[model samples]
Target: MRLQKFMAKAGIASRRKSEKIILDGRVTINNTMIKELGFKVDPKKDIIKVDNKKIFLEKEKIYIILNKPVGYITSVSDQFNRKTVIDLVSKVDQRIYPVGRLDYDTSGLLLLTNDGDLTYKMTHPSHEVNKTYIAEVKGIPNNEELKQFKEGLKIEDYITSPADINIIKKDKGKSTVKITIHEGKNRQVRKMCEKINHPVIKLKRVSFGDIRLNDLREGDYRFLTDKEIRYIKDEINEK
Candidate 1:
């Protein structure tokens, strides 16, 4: 297989990212640094190394869901040494990575896995997987604001796609709302609330597609059930 594909299969990263790793001159085969994207190797006989560490194709694919708590970044490592989702799953022996990402201040269901193909499909914009977030905003939005939110809002340079927004509760100066979005743009939910003049006080993702966060406690994680795995694969396949 191609070098990048091999690296992705070894649970190093997604195929696109593996290409960058190769171009960055971080990969080597049999002690020879390789920068070619099309470089192929026989997994059984060739010795592959990324950043000087030998890597082999992972035989077991592990999938996990974490009830991510606030203050933890969704990454394998932190340059500033802050907590990351990987720290929460230190006991898991296999090399796994977050499927996508969640902001440091945002909390809730986060998927981590070594299944590179699934990760690639789920993160791709073409899949358009729906993700639901429960957000607490500074104020209750008026009917017009709600309408604009559902229809789409101009934020920065690009306009957001149509989303589903519902008022879950309104008390005092704050309101709890449910927002479901198909695109996973950075800080999209927070920016959308801000555009409506109701900045988010807190945000938590409750579900992605049909996989609900349910009653999972904060900072805890569990392996995905077989049915859940099947559902995810089927969801992507259908798209």
Candidate 2:
């Protein structure tokens, strides 16, 4: 198998990340430092060391649904020694990586797993899986602003894809809006609201694809039920 593909199947990181690791000479194949992109290895025979630590295919796959709280980033590790979403599941025996991102301040549903194929499927823009977020913005958007959001807005150089949006609640000074979009751009919800002159005060993802946060609380997580996993596979049309 290809080196990056082997590393990805071993749950070390995504295929692209693994390629970078190989290119950086962090990976060694059979005691030789290999920076070759097309390097192939026999997983059952070749010894692979990343940063001098061995990595191999895991026997069991693990999946987790986490109710991520504010202040945690969605990465395997933080370079600044700050907390990452992976830290929240330290008790879990299996190594995993976040399927997508939720930003440092946004709080809500996040998925972690060792199934790299599923991770790639969910995170790929081509899949276009809708992610739903509820944001408390500065003020209620008038019909015009809402129309701009639904039709798509130009944030920076990139224009956003059309979003499914609606008002969930409204008060004198603040309004809660639910927006669903298929793209996973960085802080896309916050940027969208800001463009409409209703910057987000608070944001929380309520759902991803068919999986709902349900009653999960902040800083807590649970194993995905069989039914829920089945539903997610169906949504992504996973074989």
Candidate 3:
């Protein structure tokens, strides 16, 4: 396999991050520093190390979902020593990573796993996986603003893809919305709302594909059921 795949299989990092690790001059094979993306290795014959620490493939894979709370970044470690999603799953012994990212203030269904291939598939733009969020915005959007959401709006450099937006409730000063999107741009839901002049006050991802956040509470987590795993696999395999 390629060097990145080898590193991912060893549980060092995802293939993309492993490529960066290789290019950063942190990875070595057979006592020689290598920085080529095309480099391949024989797991049985090659000795691999990252920063001189030997790494071996994990025998067991773990899949978990967490109802992420506010303030924790979706990372393994923080340079500023702040909390991370990993801190929430300290009880889980295996090395796992967030499948995709949610903003620090964003809450709800976040999946963690050691299955790097599955992670790749989930994050790939080609997959076009859908994620749903419950958003509370500053004010109720009129039909024109709602049409802009369904039709897509300009964010930074580009316009967003058309989204599925449903009004769940509209009160005096705010409204609750059910918004579904395919692209996972940084702070996208909030940004989209802001573009429409509604600006999200609170956001929570309620679903990814068919997986719902359901009754999971803030800062709580649970392993995925076998059937749920099958559902994910089936969703990805769809033609």
Q: Which stretches of model 2 miss by more than 4 angstroms?
A: none
Q: Report the C-alpha lDDT of model 1 over 1-239, residue by residue, as the tens digit.
A: 88888888899998888899999999989999999988989898899999999998899999999999999999988999999999999999999999999999999999999988888889988999899999999989999999999999999899999999999999999999999999999999999999999999999999988888999999999999999999999999999
How would the candidate models be sorted by lDDT, starting from the highest? 1, 2, 3
Q: Candidates 1 and 2: which is better by lDDT?
A: 1
Q: Which tens-of-lDDT digit does each residue in 61-120 have in candidate 3?
A: 888989999899999889999999999999988888999899999999999998877787
Provide the RMSD of all predictions against the true structure, rounded to 1 decimal. Answer: 1.0, 1.4, 1.1
The local distance difference test score of model 1 is 0.94
lDDT of each: 0.94, 0.90, 0.89
Compared with the true structure, the alpha-carbon lDDT of candidate 2 equals: 0.90
lDDT of 3 at 7: 78
23-121 per-residue lDDT for model 2 (tens digits): 999999889999999788998899999999999898888889999999998999988999999989999998899998998999999999897767767
lDDT value, residue 141 of candidate 1: 94
Whole-structure CA lDDT of model 3: 0.89
Give me the candidate number with maximum lDDT: 1
In model 3, which residue pairs have backbone atoms overlapping below 3 Å?
none
TM-score attained by model 1: 0.97
